[model samples]
Target: MARKVLTVLLPLLLCVIAFAGLLLLSIPIRNVREPPSYKYGIVLDAGSSHTSMFVYKWIEEKENGTGIVSQHSMCDVHGGGISSYAENPSEAAESLVECLNQALKDVPKKRHPITPLYLGATAGMRLLNLTNPAASASVLSSVNEMLSKYPFDFRGARILSGQDEGVLGWVTANYLLENFIKYGWAGEWFRPKRGTVGAMDLGGASTQITFETASQTEDPANEVRLQLYGKSYRVYTHSFLCYGRDQMLKKLLAGVLQRHSTHPCWPVGYSAKVFLKDVYSSPCTSAQRPPDYDVSAEVTLSGSGNPILCQQLVSDLFNFSSCSFSQCSFNDVFQPPLSGNFIAFSAFYYTMDFLQKVMKLPVTSTAELRTAAKALCNESWEKLLELAPSQKSRLADYCASATFVHQLLVQGYRFDEHTFPRIAFQKKAGDTSIGWALGYMLNLTNMIPAGQMHFHKGTDHATWAVLLLIFIMIILISLVMIFCFARSSKTQSAI
Candidate 1:
């Protein structure tokens, strides 16, 4: 009897041990292995004022959703914008070499072959395309030729439409906040709110305004339909060419200054030889064509350091009269009542940061901003230099930039003092700078696929469930076999 019992018990004990071993094996497998390899991407933002290269990395297998992609490193091409090299188009491509080299150093050599490289020229290139088609082609060709030499997968380099810029920038801001991943659009519990913050990008050549509006859009041109993580978003976006602070300043000064003039915007002891062609180049000019002036003519401009006059001059650039839509920002572009908060970056943040630092004014106050800009304008050029040493090249423009920001927000965008506080002036969100580049990469990569939701939770849950079921089957089978043996032993003993 004892021997029979031992035989039946032995196999059951071995099965128990085997199941325990499998559980232990799973624990180590989960812990011992290194994380999945991360893939890389590079996006070069060739704007009007400058070119910036961003290196981004994401886990290879799980690059489809939010929270996976992030800016690895950013390198700024140390000179004028790529468009500035219009006359010498080849140099524009060559300018990227240093930044590309930095990318090579930043990312591992093994990743070089597979990593994607993209270049998207903004309003500057668009202007170049309009003004000088031949030069624009050469610029694009030059950049494409240069990018091909690198080991990275050279995605086509081209100009991004102004509307695309606004939409993508909006995408970047929301994705970084992990909105899609958290209160998911595809999941069983789909709670879609106006959780996304609006994006206002004030670059050197253009300004973009994009946000979600509940009202039905009348014009298809103003509407952008985007899909991310199985969720759909109808975003309203518009980019005003020549409305950027840099271009607007030129337009304002052109209207305000004569051949020999005292510019109210500039600080004391500041003067520049402003070229007539430079100011007339933009389509934003009232004449809608280049002025009749010697292409070689230049105007000598000196400063009277008058802030009130500067504001008045700048205000002339905005035309609030014509509204094709129910409401318009300026120049007959549609803009609904501002609803959600906004993330204003680029030149907007740059000028604000300077004022906040120099004048020690709270960003929330329009009154304080105007006061500080006026004070800064009245200050001597020497004192201006002392206050903002790093911005030596741009010091001359600070007074005008600050005042322009004030007018652009308050008068142009119609952001009230109450709503003004909602427009956060920040260069970065955590480590990443708030910009369109990240969003551009996300759009191209199809990180947010159109229909299906790629979730790690589902994959992990399925895997764990399968393992658990297999373990249970093994235990159940062992118990059944042991029972059968015990029954056979009892029958044989009775016989």
Candidate 2:
């Protein structure tokens, strides 16, 4: 009776053991359909005033359309932007060495050769190219040459159009926020409940605003159409060159200095002697340079930090009266009715972050922002420097920066109290930055297909192979167990 019981139960035990083995095998089999390895790409954001290198990595295969890229590492060049090296283009290339070395350490050695390295110059280089094409070409070539020496696959450097800059930044903002595509619990990609957000980037040499709007774009030039993950987006984008913080400051100083001596934008008791040439060298200010003034001439500026006067000074920079379109956002640029939330990044983030930190003020509304600006602008320069020792370089300009952002957004872009709070001043989303380079890299990545395994639906080589192997192993184990048990029973009977 015991032998009979053993004979019956042993096969059932073997079946249960086979079932467990099948369960254990499923993990690897499932993983086989997933991304087997990671792929990497490097993007160099060579902006007008500064350069930053970003490393991005993604799975080799994913069902969520293209690979989901996230920032792996970032390095800011020690000196000024590539355009700053106009006199010595070689130094521009050399400036990248420190950052490249960091990337070398960040990315595994094996990925260096396969990884694509790209350099995209923004408004600074654009301005340089417009003013001096040969110098621009030289800068690009030198930087390109240096990038070639590294192990990465060097993609040539090029200037991104103002429109491209704005649109790509929009893409980066939405992509990082997962506004373009979301991974569903049902194991597929789907659109999220929240709509896409607008992107507002204020850099050193330029500023950009891009958003998707249901309203028709009156000017076709401002309309940008993009398809991501099988969904379409109609976007409105405009990049105001030479309107960044630095350029904007130059504009304010020039506009104010043209008529008066004291700069209402600057804080009280602060003074500086700036050369007339430095302010008017750029194309943005070149047109504003007084014919009678010498380029090398120096003039002193005193700070007033008067809110109303400062706003008026900043407002003088925009041409709100010259709108040919039904609606315009300063400078006659046709912008559809403002829709969705806006992500203010780069200088916007850094400047607001500094003000909020230094003054401990919440800049949620226009009124709060104006009050904070008044407080910071009215404070003595010595007190500010004492409070924020690290902000020494840009400490004096905080008042002007705050004022320009306000005037530009509230007046230039027409963002009111209700819409002002919708703007999220952020430098990064998670570990990734909200910049154009990531978006540009994502667009380029579509061209490079992931070399993932291809198989038919439900019945493919990999699936069949796994199932067949498991079945054969189960059958063999069952046969062996039955044979062993039968022999044991037979031997017992003989005994």
- Choose the strongest candidate by TM-score: 2
> Where is model 1 more than 4 Å wrong at Cα?
1-31, 183-194, 285-292, 458-495
lDDT at position 428, candidate 1: 82
The lDDT values for all models are: 0.81, 0.83
> By TM-score, how accurate is candidate 1?
0.83
What are the per-residue Cα lDDT tens digits for candidate 1 across 1-495?
A: 798778778878868876995665354232236766889999999999899999999878666554358789999998878998989998998999999999999989999988989999999898889888999999999999999999899888989999989988888887776666553321222324547788999998899989887877766798888777677777889998988877877777777654226888888898888887777766556464445667678878888798888888877778888988888888887777787888999999888988777767666677777787888788888888787788787888888888888878887788887887888888887778778888888878877677757443322556666766777777878888888897987898899
Q: Put down candidate 2 lDDT per residue, 182-237, tens digits, no spaces.
A: 65432334567789999999998999999998899999999987766556778999
List clashing residue pairs in candidate 2.
none
Top candidate by lDDT: 2
Worst 10 residues of 2 by lDDT: 447-456
